[model samples]
Target: MRKLTWGVWLGTSMLLAACGGSGGSQDSGLEPPPQDPRFVADNAQWREERRERLLQPDGWASLVGLHRLELNAHYVGSGATNGIRLAKGPEKLGLLQQSGGRVWLVPERGVALTLDGEPVKARFELKPDTDQSPSIVGFDEGNGQLSLLQRSGGKALRVKHADAETRTQFGTLEYWPADAGWRIDASFVPHATPRTLEIMDITSQLQALPNPGVVEFERDGARYRLEALEGEEGGLFLVFADRTSGHESYGPGRYLYTDAPDRSGAVVVDFNRAYNPPCAFTDYATCPLPPHENRMDLAVTAGEKRYRRPTP
Candidate 1:
């Protein structure tokens, strides 16, 4: 991934200013109470940490290619003849063969690759991301990584290279000014029985994700609710949109992860920490769209703004 340059960091304030000011005061026509200094400092720190993570070698910025595997065996390499072409690395990398709902990798004669730090000299099963222990094949002296990702009942090879142009040319992450009003306290109302929500991704594939409950909150004297997807980490994953979508933010939506409700059924829905999905940075990402139930009519002028990809 690209290094987080000092220019990007210095330009953050300017970008935020250009985007606009705190929407709360302007929308409500009433000045909000002064934010606590501690809250402002903590929020700034969180945004900084989020930026650092995105610049990591294996983060979303490193994603350079996504190739769907054919039912039959096919060569994969940087060569033009290969069925699956890589943007960088060896010319003749390997062969991907699919049979009986399983996929295997067969490295080229002179190519070297490793799985779990052990040299792979023979054909081995390649596990998809859905597997408990997915196999990550590394090559190019560990600067490139490859893994199978299952989507729409099919498998695709996700390729990540440290030297990807996208990573090297990362620009800035825009945002609106932090406002305490956007940090709302919501009521988590659990469902009597667990339910499922059919979420559609940018690829038009539908996934029946778990819907654990609903979070109800009020803003500007208007009530709203957002369906929460049960998170793998005992939290709640929210894919939502408001009036800001397609105008000031990513067109599809944004994502938010909040801790599970407390005993009293309370969860802090901090829009200040809401972030754009992976699709905002790279076209290779398969990000889910916000469910209809989670869409709001009000303008949520917090969190991340639309990303402008840097020139290569």
Candidate 2:
């Protein structure tokens, strides 16, 4: 297969200078380079799964539009059915509806939540935002609730709550290949406890995520490290860029999730699961950007490659 090229996703990131390196550039001292040229098969599997996520029954590729329901209104937007705004299936767009200071769905039944666009059947139980989890995945069609991304990642939306409109507008996730070289059997360097790291994003604004620690992996004969961000359910969220970036891949970077490593520091940093940020699919999202230290100099040739965004 052809050699994979990783690209920078969000913006022009200048190399980080704080990490132990020579001015965000080539190293004169780490381990030697690689001896082979193939991305491992395990890596490819991740990509296929990610692809299915976006194009299959429920992927982002099916996204049509993110209709903002108007508060105090009962009808769907213009030209919609019975004023019940509906998010279209794998082909159409749904209208956002608001009634009695709350958002309601069309029929509140037949309409489905597009996982990536296949239409998942469900509804958002409205609730008021408090310190507790806003969207606790409850069953009551109560008042004061919404999945507002800005007002807390839409706390009202629970896991598998259904009626997720974005699921329909999903775009396809592209990639180079699942190469073994990109699948690093990482060794985790633990911290005393989960530490809150102040990191910046694609927009140069600092965002906070509980970072567990660092993971060291080998590629092209060199040992590189990436700081893992903590996600819900003890999952590890990682953001990194490599040589292939800015060339064959997206210019900003890619994102990945991994199970927290074992005691011996053995965790599979699979690139196949690497996916495009929400920004890649829709503009209504405040997707977090990768940090400076997370940038890698080598090419990660696995995972969700890029989104083949068509002209709108």
Candidate 3:
């Protein structure tokens, strides 16, 4: 059977000072050569962009609920009596029906709602994320969104609201200092034939993702290899865990992305860019776990650390 290529759907700074007074034992004036300015600036920019993406109205942090759509129909809303209870929304938002391998939404009369940004008076089919253009049901005056998501286990509804406590109370994202040394040059080793890697997600759903090759690099005189997944845009997607996992980093693992190998099969694997998955921020996400092959015994002290949710 042909293996499936799952698409990866997702989305940092400081300053320093110099010394003066070249007398009294002649201060070296070389304050540890302040990490490559370019590298530091780039890393800072990346971190800031990452934070902005997460704080967006529809970002992972805004996710408030993930309800499985197993039944034929379900009334969804914030009301306690609704079949699918939402954390935030109008009392009678809409009714969803599943048929013909598709989910349809019927807006509740007298309730304001929009289907794909347009007013809807009749039931309409909801496009799942599998489609090129998925349908979005907007509610709460556009602050809330409802979308269909299909995962390894089954189909479900992913609800996001700008006012979600998770998003409103999001905490800080810590990281180890950005060091260029973490960016290592690696060589790609292609498989004789394509292979499938069994990736188990946070939901414990095992999926056979396309595993096309491996990247090998040497760190501390030891050769380290990571199996590479064929990303949606032809880049290399690496989900990995290291010695820092559960101690200094996210327990499950972190994600990293790299451009395609060059003509000489050379790729740059920058551990400094490794980041935590969405599951680290919210429980609604079904993030894939790192395969055993990608687990490194080496401690990767770079990239993001385990998220610390702020206290009320």
Candidate 4:
């Protein structure tokens, strides 16, 4: 009887212990959030966007021309020779026109202009700006003159190639799997005073931009916030750095956006979509840096991985 009682007690104790362990595991912070269905569809869309942008319009494939006139420039269009040669005077003003079905730049006579391997001599007709202007402009439409006006009052299209050191040498970017665990349905955390955010440049210069409210969420029982900035696209632009940066991800930081989300304060921050800044590929862009407030103390392991490339 004594032996049987001892065995029963031992069995009961083990059963109770197992139940307690199971409860603790259910609430462990080690596991990621549940997967959301919408992210699967979003992933497909991003892949297509990447192909159209990075693959087809290889930056190295285009010719960059910087036309700076001392007073006026003589040139050729596509169809005439000893063409509309005019001096650097008032006569140069009305030579070219963009009207009807086409635009024309009647070049002065005896001038030569070869375009994309075609021996284009001076002519009375004009041709199109052959390159697709893919880079989003810093100015508004009809304001393309901004690009025409070069940096530091000079005129030049700083050249970058498709086979650029960054592009050519890039290995596959690392990413946290598209598991729904990272997407936390979040809500707006409004601020009374609009905050000013600064993005640090390569030269360690800071540029200030305004930010409205922020989006907030709770992770590991701690509340975190990301302030919002105005962007051309209708979404939030978040520049943030964390402990994982430089080690598991881009050294400077990773970026995220506030796309449309559901009710759970759950926003899909697809790490796979994280990519290099324009600075990575070329020197001409003015990309915004992460704000100081966005810097997180913890490691954000989910999302796009660091870009691996050969030394430039």
Question: Across residues 1-312, which tens digit of lDDT does each residue of candidate 4 receive?
Answer: 011122233223223332322111112256555556687678756755653464333342111223332233333222333133221112222234344534344434443333333334443333333325312211111111112222223222222233334444444544565665565666764468877666665434566666756777666777777776764454566776655555555555666766754444445444455555544333344445555566666567666655544454
Please say which candidate is ahead in TM-score: 1 or 2: 1
Query: 152-234 in candidate 1: lDDT tens per residue?
Result: 75789999888987788888998877888899999899889979899998777899988988998888787888999986567
Superposed by TM-score, candidate 4 places the C-alpha of residue 95 at a distance from the truth, in angstroms, of: 20
Listed per candidate, the RMSD to the true structure in angstroms reads 8.4, 9.7, 9.8, 17.6
| Candidate 3 C-alpha lDDT tens digits along 1-312 | 112232121100000000111112212344333688989999999999999999999999999999998799999999999999999999988889998788898999988888889987788999999899999999989999999998778999999999999999999999888888889999988889989899999788998989989999998888888899987566799998766666667777899999989878899998888999998888899899888677776778788876778878
- Deviating ranges (above 4 Å) for candidate 3: 1-33
Model 2 Cα displacement at 214 (Å)?
A: 1.2
- Candidate 2's TM-score: 0.57
Q: Which candidate tops lDDT?
A: 3
Worst 10 residues of 4 by lDDT: 137-146
Q: Considering summed lDDT, which 10 consecutive residues are worst modelled in model 2? A: 137-146
Q: For model 1, what is the C-alpha lDDT against the true structure?
A: 0.81
Q: Each model's TM-score?
A: 0.88, 0.57, 0.88, 0.53
Clashes of each: 0, 57, 3, 16
Instruction: List per-prediction Cα lDDT, in the order shown.
Output: 0.81, 0.50, 0.82, 0.45
